[model samples]
Every structure is written in C-alpha cells, then in structure tokens.
Target: MSFFKSLFSKKQPTARPKLNHPSELQLNDIFTFGDSFALPEAMRKQQLQVVDINTLEFQHQHYAQIVGQGSGQQLVYVSFPNNPKKLIKLSLLLSRNEVEALFDLDAFSEIFEEPGNARLRPLTKQHIYADMIADEYIQEEFMISGYSHQQDYRGTQPPQYTEDQHGREFEYHCLEGGAGERSVDIFIFENGDTDVYLSFLRPANEITELWMKGE
Candidate 1:
C-alpha cells in the first residue's frame, strides 16, 4: 500500500533562481565575445530581410526590430535606453549549402556538454534565418540547447561614444538570464543626448516572417 502511495505522489517544483547583476550567472561562449563581426549584419541587409518580433504576452514590451528571411536567415537589432541614438544588431544567415556544411562539420547534436557544464552551439548564419520562420525553430534548436543568454554591460561595442559623459558607447557581449530562458542584449550608443527609446517587446518569430515575405 505504501509503495502504491509513493508512486502517486506529486513531486515539488524546483524554485526559480534570482536575477543578479554584472556576475552571479553562468554564460555560454556564443553569448560572450563570439559575434561573427559584421557577418550577421551584412547578411541581413543583403541576403535576408529584417522584421520585428515582439508579441509575447509575458515578455516586457521592449521595442526590438528583427530583420531576416524565414528561410533560416536574419539579424536582430535592438535600440534601448541610456544611449538611444544608435542600434545594435545581431544576425545569422545560413544557405542551403551552408546547412550542408553544418552536417559535414558534425555540428548537429542533441546535447552539448563540457567537462562539467552544458554549452550552446554557435548558430550558423543559416540557423538564424530558420529561427525567424518559427519561434519554435530557434527555441527548439538553439534556446533549448542549454545555452545562456548574454549580459552586455552598460557600455561596449560599436556606436560607442567617447568617455567623460560627452557621449555613450558600449560594444561587447556578455551572458544574461537563467538556464532555459536567456537572451543577448547588444548595445549601440550614438552621440550624447540623442532621443531614441524603444518600449515595445516583440517575439522574433512574427517579425522575421514579415520581413521575409517583404511585407
């Protein structure tokens, strides 16, 4: 009788971790300084289209414009507070041939783990475009692959301004968020005192589709 009771017992749900600042979070290489330089941006403007993906009910209504093709090609450009004069973009574009290359490289794996930590594989440009067609595409292929989102400090990367408060600038990638739920926030600051603020949160799925269809 006790065994039967145990079999029917409900297990407790694990607690969610608290969000900390600067540190206290584990990050993956892709979210770090692993950008393909201008590769992502160039592909979006040339090979794939761009869109805005922000429609999740629970996500914060932050303005993000996602541009890319639904055929697994696109780039994500984010413009946020502090330095609102510039746009920071991240892109991924993969051609049919490129997809074949991935297979050749043995890049397809159900699980990615190191000695003691799980890792997320870097996306081929092709992977980025496919993600736009369906949120599920990237969600299943990349998001769920045990990779952590990046945390970009206040200042890093291009469009960065000179110090002394004359202007703002940040051009670097870092890790952010918790396991299973993570994101990469790229920063691009223009000259000081520019007026540009994005307050709409969008899901990448829909935005990428629109851009691909050229709508």
Candidate 2:
C-alpha cells in the first residue's frame, strides 16, 4: 500500500455517540458513534437519557430526532401526562440549534422525562406560537394516535382570518394545547367554534395542495 493511503486509513472520524440507559433500553441507529458522551450525572440525574438519534431531511436545515427514556424501565408519555395511565411513544422534529439550547437548559428531563417533571407555562406574544399563519390558506391536522381526548378541545394554527355573516372580518388562533389530547381553538368573532389543530405536520407538497385547494 502507498504510505499516504496507510496514513489516511488511520484517521479518526468525528461523530456523536448513540446512547441508551438502564442498560436495557434498546434503540436502533442508522449510523453508530461507538463511544457515547454523557453529561455530568449531576446535570442529568432526573432527566431522560438519550436512547436514539436520527437525522431528518424534511427541512432545509440540520434537523434531528432525539429519543430519550426514563432512567428506570419506564416509558414516556405521548398522551397528555395524566389522563392515560400508561406509556406512549411520541416524536418531535427539531433543528440542531434548538436541541442544543434545550440541552443547555437541561430541559430534556423537565420537558420530557415524566409527567411529574414537566413544567407548564402560558403562551404570550413572546413565544414561538405567536408567528402569523399564512394569509393564503388555513390548515389543521390532529393525531390521537396514542392519545385520548376530552369531550371539548380544539386547536388551530394562527393568523387564520374569517368573515362573519354580516360581512365583518376577524382573526382566529389557538393559544394552548396542541399536543396530546387537549387543545384550545379560539376565534375573535362571535360565530366561531373550534375543535382541532392547525398543523404543518405534513409534507411540503401536501401543504402546497392545501394552498391550492384554499385558493
């Protein structure tokens, strides 16, 4: 073999590790990073441990899916923290930068570990949910896939406009509860009723179809 070929073959690859906790949680990986990086125990004690990591190509960015689980043999909840007395599997799509920021806050455990550890907050203009929805069309999709629902709950993506019977126009949006089984759908006008989520949980082509239909 050539000397340069031998030298290049010995170079190390820079990669992040795959992790699973409890020594029993099994996770599959598309690519493996043999040695895992565990943050200090003091930082992660009550938090969920990384179970698997995958790349998502859906967006025009470095998107990822990081799955984690409780320290014991417990499963996380996908349904609303309380109503469902059992386990559930949920998936979140986030950009790499967002994940890093959340990690810095040690938010994984607080936001995901278990129902008891979750921190709830109200929505305000400062939150990400305040972004304006498309003026072109309105869209909503819901998945009670691994969840149960209350008799009256709905959600909607924002900046959605509506016209009243008397030709008055008003805007509508959802203030909370888009995930799991609970959500609120609110409208500024009198004749509005809400019961679902306005979602971008679909493909670009699919969303384009919605736009065309709305037109």
Candidate 3:
C-alpha cells in the first residue's frame, strides 16, 4: 500500500524564477523567428491569403500583413525587404473591445511592471503607458506563452526625446530576454497618438547585419 501511494503521489509545480525586467523573457521560445512563414496544415485548409500592405494602406511601414478567410485571424510579418528568412511572425486574434481598450490609459498601462524598488519610482500614468500599444497586442495574443506577466523596464535612462515637423516625440525602449531578445520602441507624440514598434532580435548578429545594410 505504501509503495502504491508513493507511486501515485502528485508532484508540486516548479515555480518560475522572479523576473525583474522585460529583457529576461525570451521571444524566440514562443514564436518562430528568422524563418519562412508557413501556415500550419490545419490553418492551410482555411484559405490563407497574403494581403498587400498597399491595398490596406497600413500606417506602419515595417510589417507586412497576411489574413485568414473570414476568421479574424491574422499574421504580421516583420522582415527586411528582399529577405524573407530573417522574419518574425506576430499572430493576432483580436476582439473589437480589446482593440479599442488599447488606447485607454489605464488598460494600456496594466501590462508594465509596477515600480517598487528604491532605484525605481512609480511610473506616472503617461509614463507608464506611453506609446505602449505593443503591450496590448502581446497580452491579447501571447498570454498563453507566459509573456503577458513578464516585467518590462526602460532600457535607456530618462528615455529619449526629439522634435519633428509634425510634433514633439518621446521614445522609450522596453526589452525582455532570456533565450531570445524582444525589444520594443514606444513613440509618444504631442499632437498625435502613440505608436509601438516591436522586434524579435534573437540570433542577433544576423539581424543586425540585415538591418544595418537596409536589407
């Protein structure tokens, strides 16, 4: 009886290490990076189509989009022009409510780590959310991958600011990594709404070369 009980006993779940920064989460483990886009056999049966960005007139120039037939499923492909292998695929299955809530200050800022350490001060509503649309996307799409709860911190001190013809701009770099790197740039504008640019930069050397050469 004792032997049988020991054999059938349940094991406790192992705790994940406490993460201090977004840079500690690895993007590559959850999503395929630096690879050609291929629909899963199941998804292929649903009629996949590569939509031209020009037809959609997407404001963001860095990513290319692909859509599924009638399914609300979509993939955003990030790659250098003429180079297909070095790519990051962002899978999106967003609801209307989630999309609208992204622009809300409280909803958008919820994903960032709350400040507590002596070295870190609590972030203001504007500073906490600031141009962080990527947080919403990740929360909605990648939550199952365990990145939704990861801590994110400013990669640069004081952030960065600039002025352009349109308006004043504030830029902040938030990053997470362990197995791979995921870097995001949040661009806050005085006259316009915020914008987010996310990059999965694992296997860094190759990506750096491709980016530097404007490939």
| Top-lDDT candidate index | 3
Highest TM-score scorer: 3
Candidate 2 lDDT by residue in tens digits, 81-174: 2233322223223344533432233532243233322332332233232221121221222211111111112122122224421122323332
Report model 2's TM-score to 2 decimal places: 0.21
The model with the greater lDDT, 1 or 2, is 1
The alpha-carbon deviation from the true structure for residue 100 of candidate 3, after best TM-score superposition, in angstroms, is 13
What are the per-residue Cα lDDT tens digits for candidate 3 across 41-122? 2222332233322111112222222222223444433222122444333333324353343345454455443431111111
**C-alpha root-mean-square deviation, each candidate:** 20.7, 21.4, 21.8
lDDT of each: 0.28, 0.27, 0.30
Ranking the candidates on TM-score from highest down gives 3, 1, 2
Distance from true position, residue 114, model 1, in Å? 11
How far in Å is the alpha carbon of 111 misplaced in model 3?
A: 12
**Candidates 1 and 2, the one with greater TM-score:** 1
After superposition of all CA atoms, the RMSD between model 3 and the true structure is: 21.8
Candidate 3: which stretches are off by over 4 Å? 1-48, 52-70, 73-77, 81-172, 197-215
Deviation (Å) of 138 in candidate 1: 17
